[model samples]
Target: MTGLGEDVPQTAGAIWRRTVPVWAGLTALLVATLSLAYVPMGRFGIVVSLGIAAAKAGLVVVFFMQLRKPDPLLRLTAFASLIFVAFLLTIIFAEVLTRAPPTRPGTVMPRSAPDMPGLGQRAF
Candidate 1:
């Protein structure tokens, strides 16, 4: 009965633990996000929002979701999707910036309006 209680080890023996630096980095990022919430950045808001979202999403995918593990194809697929989305965004913005809208300056209608012959006024 002398050695009956010696089986338990110290708390450090659990082995499963997260690094302090990672938690610290995440906390800092979170604090930065909170601080940005109070600032009125206007047009810059979209850029800032996307940047922060990307950083936060990267953290979630890399650490929380452990996407860096075995299946490397997932990483490639994600990168490819980002590329395609960026390409699509570029095309949409280009079109929006280059296309001109129809207008009749001072008046409310176009100069060359189409003459529509209603069924009741048309002669065969």
Candidate 2:
């Protein structure tokens, strides 16, 4: 009678089989992200880049962290943490977008000051 807590011995081959595809996918995503940086897409560039990043992060969390296992508590905790992060990002974005633009200088300086009799001219 094996308990749920008992560790199952997995062969190296089994581990490799599961992880190889994930590694390849992550590598592909990395290449895509780097390539996207060079191609200018204006405002949509950030959206696409962030989407790829989120996908990469999801793969890492699910496979590397072994979050795919049937653990209700673990999944719930992960979900809660993601929600908190989303909330924080929303607040930060709101603050940044709502801020006023900086004020520009009223007047530009002249290359040389006008020669006033008492100002620049020194009486010897």
lDDT tens digits, residue span 4-117, model 2: 324755889878998999999999999999999999899999999999999999999999876877777878999999999999999999999986654546543333445434
TM-score of 2: 0.66
Clashing pairs in 1: none
Cα-based lDDT for every prediction? 0.69, 0.83
Model 2 off-target regions past 4 Å?
A: 1-9, 97-101, 104-124
Per-residue lDDT of model 1, residues 47-118, tens digit only = 887787788788877766656665567678878888999999999999998866546355344234356555
Candidate number achieving the greatest lDDT relative to the actual structure: 2
RMSD of each: 12.1, 9.1
